[model samples]
Every structure is written in C-alpha cells, then in structure tokens.
Target: MSSVAKVVRSARGLLLRGSFKQAATQLRADISTGPQQQHGTFYEFRTYDIKPDHLSAFLKLTDDNIQLRTAHSELVGYWTVEHGGLNQVFHIWKYDSYAQRTAVRAALAKDHDWMSKYISKMMPMLNSQDSEVNYLVPWCKLGKPPKQGVYELVSFQMKPGGPAVWGPAFQAAINTHDSPGYAQLIGVFHSEFGDLNKVNVVWWYESPDKRAEMRHRAHGDARVVAAVRESVTYLVSQNNKLLIPTAFSPLN
Candidate 1:
C-alpha cells in the first residue's frame, strides 16, 4: 500500500480506538504550522471527501474562490490525504472574529461566479454524508513564525463530559513545561462543523528533536498523565507534514 494509505489507515485506527486522552496527547505531538501565521479566533477544521474526477475542480475552486476571495482569515498550510483515508482534503483557515466569519460566508455565498463555477464543480465529488467541520482550539503561542521543521497534527474528539476534567490537566501540563522546542499554546474556537463534544489542540515544535523532547516530557509529566487518565474517552487522528505557506496568499 502507498504511504498516504498508511497514514489514512493509522488515523482511522486512532479514531476507532475512541480514546480522547490518547487522541489529545497524540495530537499535541502532531502539531505543525505553515507560512501564513495569524493568531486569534482561528476557526474551522474543514475536511472534505471529494470525488476523484472532481478533485482538480475542487482544488481550482479552493484556489480561486476560498483561497483568493476570502478576506476574513488567511489561508494557512494544508495537507492532502492520499492513502489510508478515502479521498480526504484537510485545511485550516484563520479568522479574526466571529463577525468576520459570518461576513466571509455571506460574501462567498453571494458570489455568483464562485457558486456557479466552483461549487457546482464540487457538488458531484463531495461526500456530503460524512464530511465534517470542527471548531479548532488553538494551542500554540502567538508571535513571529518559528524556524521551519516537521510537525505532527493530532486532534482529540472529546467525549460528552470529558472537557471539564481534561481541560485543567491539559492546561497544567502546558504550564509546567520548560522544554526547549515547545513554543506557544493557543486556544481555537471551532465553528460551523462537528459535534460539540470535541475540543482540538495543536502543538508547535521547532524541530523533530524538540518534538521528541516534548514527547519525552509528556511521559513524566504528572498533569498530562492525570488528564489522560481522567478523560479516556475520545477519538484521535494524527497527520505529520512539513509546514509550507501558500505561495500566492498574504500569509507569506
């Protein structure tokens, strides 16, 4: 099987395990960033399952309409899943405020050309039945971009009653850490997608060695251990990729 297939399969496996704490820990390790950096009110972890023939059309639409016209948020880095999952596309968009999100959606909806050309092109390829939009809970600190490196992206789908218990432990872990590669922790508000029981956290690493250092820290961190033990119910999906900013976007 192809490497992409392996990744998709691994993500699916994590999802199937349904352990929120495990997922959160895994996701923290997977966090990485792209070129376009903006903090504050980052929204939407939009995932799509596009049809093969329509993939090109979808990319073109995203490139032109969503990427080009949307002014509310900058287009950050994104990853195209090729292997384990079935025709998946994942990307992150940053927004300044709730009002901006609303305005951008309205504007996009009214764009006749975008709706007619791009949306129409994507209609056939989209698996509307299983697609998801989850609110993002940012975990990285805000500032100038860090040096380039590989980062892991892991997300936790908290169980209905897990956050209250898990949140403190997670926060404590962040507070106690003094690791070298650990950067910033930002909270994200996910809007317009997914169930309410989920909270997503992203971690940033300066390098692979730093990422490994954090993982080693996690092993001995009492707070992290406690949190994981308390909120054991959740789903986790992980993706590791190099952060690459959009060549044409303002984020660069």
Candidate 2:
C-alpha cells in the first residue's frame, strides 16, 4: 500500500487499542497547515446517539422542519454517521451570539408542530448519556471569511492508523477544487469524548447543487480517492438549514 495508507492503518490499530487521544493528536498534527485563525461566527456542535430504528424518523423530522425552513434561525449544516466502528448523529447550528441560541431553542421547544411531530419521533432512540452540546470557537487568527449559506457537515472517525493518509487527501481536495455554490470552507475540529469518537470537516455551500459539485470533484480527485481507499474507514452525514443569531444563552 501507499505510504499514507500505511500510516492510516497503523493509526487505526492504535485507536482500537484504546489510544483515542493519541490517534487524534497525530492526525491533527499531520494536517497542520494554513492560517491559525479565520473569520467565522461561533457555533454550537450538538451530538446525539439515536436508536437504530428511530434514525429514519428523526431524520425525516429534521429534514421536514429543521433542515428545510428558517423559521427560528439558519440550519447551517448537518451530518449522520452510518459505519466506521462508530455510530452517531451530529449537526451544527449557527447563531449571532450565545443569547440568540437560547431564545431560538426556547421558541423551538414551544413550537407545537416541533413538539408533536419532531420531538415525538425521536424520543425512543435518543441516547441521553452519550449526547453532548458544545460551543465551537473558530480559529480567528486566520483572515478567512466565516462561511454563510447552506452547508454540509462531514464527521470523521479516524482509526489510529488512518490520519497520515486521510489528512493530506482531505486537505488537497479542499484547497484545489472549485466548489460551485460553496460560500467557504469552514474549520475542522476534533470531537470531545463525552460527545463521541469523531472529528469533523465543515463545508459551506450556497445551494445543494453547489455542494454536490464539490463532493463530486473531491471524490474524483486522485488524492482523495486514494486516501479513502487506503487510509481510513469514514462516515459522512448532513443537514441543510439556515443559521440565525441565538435567541438566548445556551449556558443560561
């Protein structure tokens, strides 16, 4: 196998042996290039571990209500994990500030439709213990603009041996491709353990078509193709929604 793939396989072995933090740190360091800071709004990354049966119902509700409309605020992006030794669902919501998030969530909680259709659907499979909610502070040191518009969130669960190969392939795709309706490429992040065993790559697109175009290009790229085949077992999931200023404090 290629050198990158070899690195990934080794990493995966380490992760399986319970060295999650070590594997993650190695991957982060391998792909450590670009400005240290970028322009972007703070985000709340919420993670959930749903029941296998309830997955479909929850996704349906999200697509119908949360992903499609902007009644409360922008959806920003969404993703779900299917394979790769890890099983979970994750989505990112944008807010103008912490306060706005509080208000919007409260409103959503009270929305009769959301209560009847959305919440009721996922009550069965929801894993209350493993779920998490956290704030993402973008690397503001870089001058890149904060991404706006519809976006897709891709979360990766890198095994101990996967990072060396996957990291470069991912970076190459993001840097070289011409994303059709893509607004910007947001920062990537490592997952917090209480959350799940994963890391994330956030992509910004103006429309679904644009997002598709970028993915097509990335998949077609020799580097990404090679990386996918050799380096890691990955999972991708997404949600399409608008982002708005948080209505209230998530902390409060």
Candidate 3:
C-alpha cells in the first residue's frame, strides 16, 4: 500500500477490517504503472503423461477446448512430446503474478460449462500430470518460433547456488549454438517457485535429421565444448523432451 493509502486506512478504521483492506488494495491498483508483469512474468509449465492410444484423442479434445483454457490466462506454447517421453503432452502458460494466477484459476473453477467441457473430459485421458512455475532468465528473453517447427525442451538441474554458479557458462553455450546455422533458440527459463535451481531451454528445429546434424556440428565446435565443459561442473542432471505442435496451438 502507498503512504496515502495507509493514512486513509488509519483514518477510516471505523469501517470493517475487510473494507479497509479492500480500500488499500484498490488504491495500490490505481496508482500502478501497469500489472506486476514488469517485475518478473511467471509461466506455468505442465506435462501430461498419457496412454499411448489416447494421444490423438486427447489432443483433439484439448484443441477443441483452447478457448476455455485461454479465457483464464495467456497460453505461451503447447506441444506433445515426440522423442523422449512417449505420449507426453507439454504446455506453458504465462501469468502476470501469483495473485493473478490464483484469481484466474478460481474464476475457471466457478465456470460450470468450462469444467464440464474441458476439465472433466481431459482428466480421464491423462495417466499423470506435472506442473512447474518458472521465470525467464535475466539475460534471456522469451521468443516465438513458427508453430510448425519441431521443438526440444531441455531441463537442467544446476548446483545449489542457483544461477550464480552456472549462468555464465550456460549463456556462453547458448551463444555458441545461436551461430550461422543451428537449431533456433526459442527461449530459456529457470525455476521461480518450485524445485529450485532448474533451468529449461527450448529450441526449434525444422526436422529431426536437421536437429541431429546440428547436434553433431555443435559437439565438434571448440567454443561449445569449452562452454559445456565449464557448465557441467555445476550441472547436476539434465533431461530433454522433443515436441511437435498440435493443431490449434497459438505458437503454431
């Protein structure tokens, strides 16, 4: 709350506590330049492990409900795992803040039609689901690639000091990969709310063979080798997921 808001609240204590709190919140909202997105935008990343036979059906059901889910917040990107984890579905959502996320979730929960058309139908097809809250790294910006390209998501767990120990090395490696010819870097993000010290790098490729050739070339580059060697000292473990955009994905 602002200083003015505090003073007003003090003077208006005769009102109920709830009313006073609401007044202060309103005042803060009024004077804000914009939403909290300027501070650090948050992303909700989800992965659904589904039954092999349900993949096509699930994607279709989800595609049909895009409007319902997007009514709550921004859908950054969505894809189905292709190479690493079979029948896995992945999606990323952007929210201005935790309060906004909570509000959007609550609103969606109260919508009966949305629940019946989407939540109820999609839940049965998924074997399991996992979610993470992440923020884009300071040096990296979220990017957009044609939804038709292949995508690879690499999740990295770094040593416990967070980005301090591994950031520069990783950035150097990313720089090396973004050369004259290579897989396109989509975006880079690190954990913000859960499972600390984890980083996710997304890349876009034209084809599986192109990705393979790029990897072989990247491995041969002296700069990439040096960067990876330095970064690995602080890297605990890493996993990758290859994805293809489903129909109706905004990024596509």
Indicate which candidate wins on lDDT.
Answer: 3
Off by over 4 Å in 1: 1-42, 53-57, 64-67, 72-77, 82-86, 94-100, 129-145, 149-151, 174-193, 205-252
Winner on lDDT between 1 and 3 is 3
lDDT of 2 at 224: 55
Which portions of model 2 show Cα errors greater than 4 Å?
Answer: 1-40, 67-69, 85-87, 129-186, 189-200, 203-252
Instruction: Report the CA-based lDDT of candidate 3 relative to the real structure.
Output: 0.80
lDDT of each: 0.52, 0.52, 0.80
- Against the true structure, what is each candidate's TM-score? 0.55, 0.43, 0.82
Measured by TM-score, the strongest candidate is: 3
Error of 1 at 128 (Å): 3.5
- If ranked by TM-score, best first, what sequence of candidates would result? 3, 1, 2
Pairwise TM-score winner, candidates 2 and 3: 3
* lDDT (tens digit, per residue) of candidate 1 on 118-180: 777777779753424444434444333454443334455554433333444444444554343
